[model samples]
Target chain A: MSPPLADLSAPPAIRPSLAARLAARSGALTGSTAGLALGHAQANLAVLPAVYAADFLRFCQANPKPCPLLGVSEVGAWTIPSLGDDLDLRSDIPGYRIWRDGELVAEVDDASAFWRDDLVAFAIGCSYSFEEGLIAEDIPIRHIEEDVRVPMYRTSIDCTPAGVFSGRMVVSMRPLRPPHAIRAVQISSRYPAVHGAPVHLGLPHLIGIADLARPDYGDPVTVKDDEIPVFWACGVTPQSVIASARPSFAITHKPGTMLVTDRRNSDYAVI
Target chain B: MSPPLADLSAPPAIRPSLAARLAARSGALTGSTAGLALGHAQANLAVLPAVYAADFLRFCQANPKPCPLLGVSEVGAWTIPSLGDDLDLRSDIPGYRIWRDGELVAEVDDASAFWRDDLVAFAIGCSYSFEEGLIAEDIPIRHIEEDVRVPMYRTSIDCTPAGVFSGRMVVSMRPLRPPHAIRAVQISSRYPAVHGAPVHLGLPHLIGIADLARPDYGDPVTVKDDEIPVFWACGVTPQSVIASARPSFAITHKPGTMLVTDRRNSDYAVI
Candidate 1:
């Protein structure tokens, strides 16, 4: 019964604690964070030069639902106190994508060699925060159940721009039946620190998504006839903005992979 | 450019305080309580003889989202202290529909003539609690905007039957674009004392709703091409149960007319 996509996904193995997961990333484990570090917060990383940090912070704050800011590392310092101890942003993510002049220049396992004193790192919350809550509620996340990346799409809904950062919002997609989607929206709303609730659903065309089969980013999952695509503002949005608003140099976690942190997702839930 | 319906509705006059609303109802100034006693709790009334009261209470407890029990009057007593000190089951609601053998026999302005010591009253929370929340958030409710009764439908989703009480769930619908629907889910989830979250959305067929244009109950709201019908469990569900349960003697508030209490809607919000 093995499908042709068998090589496309890895197993849901026993994950390390937040600290161990970060340490693994620090070493040479270049991969996604889908099923790793089960109970802790995993964030989308975007490190920009000090010059554009203020504008980017405003962009994140203005679009809180899509770009929920979880932690911001001190300028020139690689550590964020609230995230973890001994957490060096430069080398803790599974991989880093370095962008220069609005193009990806290279993908690397460690960013310590690229660290600059004037660089500031921003950790925005991801849907993984509420995925834990969803799983705890016994709702099956389709992509997670099938062992694939959550589909991501670029939408017509525009994000309020700040400084050099401005672009359409990017969203992650999940497929669920009517009742489950209703429950998902209710459960996800409690974690506003994550991408809370959905931005678009059912009628994807209204949001300018031309094809669900071909996502703008991430691997596509099967959509059942009875199910509708539910979209959440994605963490990839900041990365997309970094690509579009290319500074002289910028660093972000490779898509799918994230910065696993010491903080628990429950700490950020509003209900 | 005002329509005939608008002119008729415009003279609802000054919105009354809770005290004024209660006094009007008690004095047989019978009318729909919608938009009256703003910010106060308006409830769905269900009165049954004491012999079947405990089993009916179990039915409500089993289905809290649809039949949120606000308060229950003591056997033969007219007042429910938790809902209001002056609350009278027989006359506190502007209008009442008397049922015999599950068939509506007649409507009455005041039930004081029919009041008996054996009758017990149950006050159930209403979706009006969350409507205030939605309005506060600037999300437009279609029926409220159109000044029509909120559209309700009898769905195939069944409520757990207790004793002689059993029937399909009744859902009140409001049409909104996908994003607003998501926000409604979050806002309504805060008021579990009302019908919390939603029973269904997007695909009405999944819930046995074959047509949206002709609802079994309430006026049809205009669903724009870009809008989707979002459904919430309605307090009318108990009324639907009465229809199927075929109780020999039962009384309910006439649709649109409700019992207004001193308790603020905010008092029932969980978060």
Candidate 2:
């Protein structure tokens, strides 16, 4: 949905910060933004009409361990000053997924045509924030090091649903040795702005995740001999809920292509 | 080994403070002192002669993850002023295990006869400290509830050997759901003096343990379907190391048996 930013991505120049990244995203830069805006926070975008905004907010509050909320916008608002000044929710994310009546309509580079007065934008925390912390600690996150999207699974753990949002929880997996996993838990626990610490670790079957080699979303990475699969709540939970709610109109970030914001992960560390 | 504390395994007829507990332990009142002096520190006891004491102390220093040293008494001295006022190491513990050439020779209610001029007593932090914290937070420890010893295992993870003391790391197993396990990690991390956070969680096979149904030490507790096994470095590591060293003379607390002190668990809480 971003026009100006989308055009900037076509050039062979590097993108820096939200301003430059948004400039790239708005110009049809429908690509992954995993490491594009290094220092800024990357968010999972969810835009719904004002009619379901209150219910969705409550849903997030009720299921905080899985759906940690970062920021919300006013009705019909495309710009959320809290996240980033001049950042357009409709065009900031690299790619937008348009959902109509709870089904994927079409994936667009920008949401300019779908912008509605009643639509409210929401930014939820994602694993990408804490993943950066892990990397800085020299703790190897197998998925990131292997150049793959972290494997996301649909767990049997259900979210506390609101009026128009209800579904099973989604989790992202990162395989690490036990000690490394313990450190990851300790580090991630500090950032409640992110999905927080993992909802489950090991015992995939206990959480309704049947297969390690096959994931419901994203790419699967190798689980080394000394590693254990550590699972954290995924921002994709809200998307699954929206799909189940089947709203007549909705918008969200394309998986792995998030809305990079001015917020730093350390800003939310509790300890 | 603690005959004074072991004799009265039932709920204390009269609850005692740190001073009273020390008096009873020294007075040959052998009984199970699990909750005898609430809000005070209890320790793992390891008594060795000058020859093996150096090596054992080195073992603990090398593997601080398991054998966290609270205080070590001077050789031939049975009293340690730091852990407790007038704390006599020779007879303060209600029971003591007397070992000869690495073999448990006798289970004595007191160590009056076994106390050697070159013997050195060490006080290591015990899980009882963190377990008390968890219990205060309303977390249920099944073994304590079932009136059985905590199940422990000798894992394939080896300790960094020191002198003649070295062996596989021993871990205590506690079963908890993911959420409780996460909270436990946070709580335990505050008390690094007491082995700190768990060394491993879930995927027991990775640590060389194959069956949860059978334990190498202590009694097995129920493992719920939704629960994942949480493992922590145990105080038993010293006992295992001493077994490997096969010292001519060594004394330690029997499994589940401990030496109560005047130090409060809160005194050691880092945060």
Candidate 3:
């Protein structure tokens, strides 16, 4: 489980570097890194065999809103120096999900056991970057306020196809009053690498979301009468696409267990 | 009247400089400058007495979305050289609406007779700059396509008050399909000086706009069943505020007529 709001708000007395955090995670820090290295960029991870890397890259390029590609490692390389110095792709993340034929076969602390010379690591931008922006602007994030996960919905919108990777676009929802929603658009638009502005707002059914209370993934929080549900393109989209593609072997960071990088979230802001 | 779409699309064999256009207007060219000087920035003009200038500047600073101030000339000066070299404020624009105590007293071709030593000229960012951007991006602007004025509405949302200048925010509406609307947000966001992104979208009544067909100003264009109305903070807002404030004397560019500046529209794009 993620830490409470009070705990998340207070950083550790000693702020460790990204290299130090990854080394600690490799040793014993095996859990979600939700609020760790708060100002730095945290990335969603996907590792696949060299054969599927090209197709996946094209998929991300075509559907940038959902799969904002931050960095892609060279084939068989464990280090993506652009994202973090001295980082090991196989062991840097705190937790990993190992998949075979798109089925989750095991959850592990590190991926060294399944590491292969034919693997490629893909780093994707996450909404955590923009959520920090929203919070900085004092925009109320209901899920964080209520201590629940942001609701995720599988929308009617389709991701543009690229080879074997194709599926419906998935979105995360946050309920905000009209004024806050407008401000959210402005704030979020600055961070285009992290899903950018909203993909949809107000009318959910137009995007085929049947109920605000029943999300396809994550937990639903309160949507007050004064607030309208705002939706953003989600990182989970690539995970969903990977499942539908049914690759022979695949790996992803366990949800919320992101790769904490040396890059600050502000680095991704376009303006 | 503005020229037809075909004429507007075809640039004159020899494009005129800002000074040349002003000289033409000062002579016999007295009509809307819509679609003229295709690539250059065009601004809405507001001239007020020195007594009201300070409050008006504060009003613009407080309500930037609607009244994005581009350049404010020195008190009683006719030249805002930053906007255009040798540009005379009194006779540059093709048409002017002279107001006395908030009532439209005259529609003149030149403001030289009305110009006073106590008057201050304000050049405000206009939507025409961003409209060119949208058109370049292949997003069809309904008003421009139908060759009519863009619809404007007085919203329930109030402007942040500054001194004696206070009124409801006025917005300009455009109907775009969902995909085009999403792209519009991205394109418009790059030009913050010209209203930036939309203020409200989709549900019009949520902002107290009861009827889309009967706009408070400008001609209404078609809002198709597949389209959602996107609203942006409009330059007309200051005019509306001036009407309500009822200053002793004021001057504004007549509707659809703007002051063509030497600055390229591209210069205003942040990205």
Candidate 4:
């Protein structure tokens, strides 16, 4: 019916991220979703029992830079129509990390079997959206060039506590030349739904990152001598909070494996 | 027809910048313009003969970051109506530096004696506009806090050559913490007419500045250990170029004493 896909060699950006979403829906995309949807906004998935949804929502509202909410599903609902027409929350993400009592218990491609009637899913904005914004302006993204996950660090900056949700803020790093770093701030500031501009830059130890190579989450990428590390409040921050809050049952997209959304990245751009 | 002025003890920002402009016109204010008119856009004056105006205009166009043009008067004209209703080129600035063949020959309170029929006055955008924007956002300005001139440096970064105008870029430094640095970029980027965003930050040595303590122009303020220096392309670049190109006769505002225009800083903001 679809003419068997006309151009397989076209760049991922040229093809809609819907292709990645469809592949994920079929259990074919079982790994990272970093470059798969270059143009569309991707989302970090967070699922928790309905009992914890209100406080988690309050946490997101309190710490907007780290937990910018893209959408939240009704209890037990798998689809958020505003994000996509065909998005199935339980099976759409490439991978999911199941947590119990603050410990990661399982990693799975399909989350359908673990779904409960009281489950509530939140689609948090991802840095991948702003990464696309940076790349559009010809600012180099080091982690993307190195073909690795963006380096994320747990910082000494604490998130504002909301009921039971609280933890240190997590940040994603991108090393850019000074001019590009300034330009990146301008470009990323337009997409506040994602992490927004950078939270910290230049001084790493001041934010409690002792060594550049040792990242708390995601792989370490090359930070050239000529470049200064610019940091954005990361989506992984919610995951860190979940671990700290020790919710009885929770789930999240595996680091770097995001929910490829139908929404264009520009949808979240304020101006 | 106007009522008597009230609240002299109130902050200078409470009064319109026109107050400062009128003071300069009346010979009542003849020192640095800093902190005099806080919310207005001030300008750097560059008066040159018609023979060199075209090349200098090209230089401003070529290197907009360093020499953002606010208004260029008609050849031999002293008034830029767009910048102010009653701005006079000769006596409206606190001090003027008279240059002869690239040498500083005289410092005068008024340049009416030096006005020539072939002279063209160029009003370049000053960082004071963006500084007001930064201060409005509650970001502290270090130089203003210490009551000293902002530190300026000549960078190794070369300007795009335009005929007889060619020289290194000059930049002004403002030290801020990491979060404020990112915010400053966003705030300043909106005021493209006034140096736009910072050209460099973090590593000063990379831009050829050997010591932060010794600036090429202005006084250095204390850069706290927690703060990193953010650099903006400065209005001083045009004066530096005048020295390098050695235009036979030129007139410019003394470093800190700018042409305080009636125009509000918001007039220069893009969005």
User: i-RMS values of the candidates, in order?
Assistant: 0.9, 1.6, 2.7, 0.6
Full-model lDDT, candidate 2: 0.84
Instruction: Write the candidate numbers in order of decreasing lDDT.
Output: 4, 3, 1, 2
List the per-model TM-score of the A chain: 0.92, 0.92, 0.91, 0.93
Q: For each candidate, what TM-score against the reference?
A: 0.91, 0.88, 0.84, 0.94
The DockQ value obtained for model 4 is 0.79
Model 4 off-target regions past 4 Å? Answer: A1-15, B1-16
User: What's the number of clashes in each of the models?
Assistant: 0, 39, 0, 0
Over 4 Å off, model 1: A1-15, A18-28, B1-28
Q: What is candidate 4's CA lDDT for residue A153?
A: 94
- Candidates 2 and 4 compared by TM-score, better number: 4
For residues A137-223, write the lDDT of model 1, one tens digit per residue. 888898898898888999998899999999999999999998899989888887889888888888999999999999999888999
lDDT digits (tens) for residues B180-244 of candidate 4: 99999999999999999999999999899989999999998999988999999999999999999
Q: Tell me the deviation in Å of residue B100 in model 4.
A: 0.9
How well does candidate 2 score on lDDT at residue A154? Answer: 90
Tell me the tens digit of each residue's lDDT in model 2 across A188-231: 98888888887778678888988989999999899987787888
lDDT tens string, model 3, B110-168?
88999999999999999999999899988999998999988999999899988889999
Q: Deviation in angstroms for A39 in model 3?
A: 1.5
Give the TM-score (0 to 1) of chain B in model 4. 0.93
Chain A of candidate 2 gets a TM-score of 0.92
Query: Lowest-lDDT window of 10 residues in candidate 4 chain B?
Result: B10-19
Q: Put the candidates in TM-score order, highest first.
A: 4, 1, 2, 3
lDDT at B74, model 3: 94
TM-score of 1: 0.91
